[model samples]
Target: RLPVRVDVPVEELTRDDGLFLVGTPRGVLRARNVVLASGSLNCPKRPPASADLPATLRQLDSSAYRNAAELEQGAVLVVGSGQSGGQIAADLALAGRPVFLATSRAGRLVRHYRGSDIFNWMTLSGYLDVPRREIVLPSGKLPPRGLLGATHTISLQSLSAQGVVLLGRFMGIENDSLIFGDNLDEHMRFADESSADVKRFIDDYIRRARLNAPPAEDDPAEMIAPRLPSPPIHSIELATSGIRSVIWCTAFRGDFPY
Candidate 1:
């Protein structure tokens, strides 16, 4: 049986004589071929603007947020629109707390489509298992995962319908006000296009494979689009906004030391 190490903090990793030398608190271990299974998401990433946020307002990383009952008695400002940000904002709003979401260009996905889970369609379409070498992006980087609810579809439009105020890309704090970019419409459009692209990919796969999948059903949640602010909100004075807490659901970073 192969040996496994648990609760061992790797202090350093080195290569010598075609062998990997791992230094841990206990001792050094040698192996012919080492597989680094240490994950990349070891630290929460907050925007540089986070440093300029007002001192009185409470700020918590997305990783630290548990529930609305723990927050102060005021509105919440979720400063991202990825999976965590969207879900947290939805959770707070559903719990009867006012929530303001600073949106990003992150895409959305429907949990279930065409009488099957979206993952099933993805596996059948051969898109889920595409090799890394086959991925081609303009910047030669991998694409980020889109926002998909755990058991239901979550979209910007649906969040707006639930009384959560949506704002544009957060620029920074200016003169005690939260400055935002004037691209809320563009952000929303991008989410719609992303969902449409995925649906189109699955549709093409079904047609090419001659699979007799049931017809697509209209998701009423996605159809609800609240009228966006004209010219988009460029700034909101923090003092008057009633926002007492800010959740930095921005992203995570790899904390690899080698």
Candidate 2:
């Protein structure tokens, strides 16, 4: 049987010969090998604009954010377009709050294409098993993850249609005004192109494999279409715009105590 320790904080780890000594709150422990699973989402990131916010305003990283009910009275500025930011912005806007979503160019995928889930299509296409060595970028960086939902795809486009103000990537805050980049059109185009590419891949895979997939339907078009245009906002005066809170969901990093 393997022994396990829980609720102990690891303070230090040192290697001697081929073994590792771990210092913990309880005591020192010895191990032949150590596997660090610190987790990717342990530390949430905040934007630079968050640093100079007034004391009166509330700020919550996406990890600390629960729901619109948890926020104080006033509008909210969600400073990312990733899954967390997209979902949270939709949630707040649906709850009748004036929500502004600062978007980055993130890929979008359909929840269900034809009669299959997008994940199933991904698996069938062998996209999930792509080797890192074969596809590694020159910069050694992976591509940004696409926004997907298990139940149903949460479309930023749909969120825009639902009264959520979509802005370009946040630049920084200048005095009382928040500045944003002028790449909103480019971001929207990228999302649309990425989604089309995915759909095309799926269609080709079905044809090549001779899979008996359902015929094309209009639902896909209706679902992917943006009902409203993304707002062309360069900057907004935070105080005058009635925004009282900011939620930064830029990225997550692993936090290793030792």
Candidate 3:
């Protein structure tokens, strides 16, 4: 696929009496046999755990990442790439903001070499039925999870090629300046280089877990990425400290959606 864009309003999920996993306007997307293969919640968000960092980092920015014009440039940081992060990064680049995008999980490879859309590998591989933790279990070796679904990993190379800096997950934020885990770059580069390896890792991990294989022979990724420096953080002193606006693109957790 060559990245053809689509225009469908999700609101079409609300026209029926059926139970809604999500209540979109179209109608309830009902399932007689509901299974949560990836029991993740909505996007994870930041919390007010420090002093000096603006309280702003802890809440949802009404405009999302695309309208980052209100943010100051030079050191802008974007936290996730699920659709929102990608759009935000694209908007920042178009707006010419010195942007930085970061995420812990490298995304899936689009099916076509040109990135039209991800390989329907998740649905294709039947992972939708596997327990979610198969990807995280120490003794398990599933696909690297780079193939689950469409991720925002919104163009790591594109960001760099276009001059947008990228980072790893947000450990915390420093006074106006953000503090990230130390291995941000290394972790990211590894994800970027071998998405294929990540996929293999995830595949094996799940199989092992399903078969109750012992830890002695779990097949981790053949390509071992240099582990990120245990802790990654971005620290900038508040006021004129380069990063004027911090866009937290981290994910949201799954709630009952009541």
Candidate 4:
């Protein structure tokens, strides 16, 4: 086997005399070519607003959260409406713990559609094979992957149905309250439309290719969001609220400083 190094983190990379010099805690390695294989989701990105939270509350990144039982007794606030945030909030609610979920603009995905898994349709419809250059949106960023549960569909509305108090985008901390934006309805609508857009794209592809796919069917899980009696909470007092811990599922970034 080729020489291998385990548990040795690369500290820096430089070029000298047309060769790459890699610095690590073990030693320096000189090579003709180097591939920085660190993954995009390797570094957890904590929200800057978290700094305003009082030090009494425990803060944990999405990666460090194992289960609801490990948390202190009281309500839990989950930030970000992406896959990690949504699922963790659901898990906490199901465990009989009060949950407050701060929503984001992440899209939702229906796991199964038109008598087939969404992943299968994406593969057959060539949606997954699109070049990265062609898929970047007007905002100069790639469209994010839609949020879905491990075995089914999940959405902010669904979480709300499960007794999880839905809140708008987490802004920052005020005097004694956690400030939130008043765009919860907008975010929920965006997630619904995004899922519909994907299903429509798949439908058009099937028709153009003359494939004998089954007729589109409504997914109960996707349609499970019930109408709310009032708008979601815009701000919450952390002290008055029974919240004791917060799980930050605000996503991650792959940053290379060296």
Task: Give the number of the best model, judged by TM-score.
Answer: 4
Q: After superposition, how far is residue 93 of candidate 3 from its true place, in Å?
A: 1.2
Displacement of residue 172 (Cα, Å) in model 1 is: 0.2
TM-score, cand. 2: 0.86
Candidate 3 lDDT tens digits, 1-258: 643334423332232455444344554455444434445554455545433457544334413543655664365667665445656666777778776666555453433222222244345445456676855547453333342223433345545555666556566654445665555566556555565554564456546657433333222222233323224335544455455566655545554433
Cα error, residue 144 of model 3, in Å, equals: 11
Q: Of the pair 1 and 3, which is ahead by TM-score?
A: 1
Query: Best to worst by TM-score, what's the order?
Result: 4, 1, 2, 3
Report the number of clashing residue pairs per model: 0, 0, 53, 0
The superposed Cα distance between candidate 4 and the true structure at residue 2, in angstroms, equals 2.7
Task: Give the poorly placed runs of model 2, Cα more than 4 Å off.
Answer: 6-9, 16-18, 131-140, 218-231
- State TM-scores per candidate: 0.87, 0.86, 0.52, 0.88
Cα lDDT of model 1 by residue, 157-187, tens digit: 8888888989998999999999988778888
Q: What does each candidate score in C-alpha RMSD?
A: 2.7, 2.8, 10.6, 2.4
Mind giving the per-residue lDDT tens digits that candidate 2 earns over 57-110? 798898898889999988999988767787888789879999988888787777
- For the record, the alpha-carbon RMSD of candidate 3 to the native fold, in angstroms, is 10.6
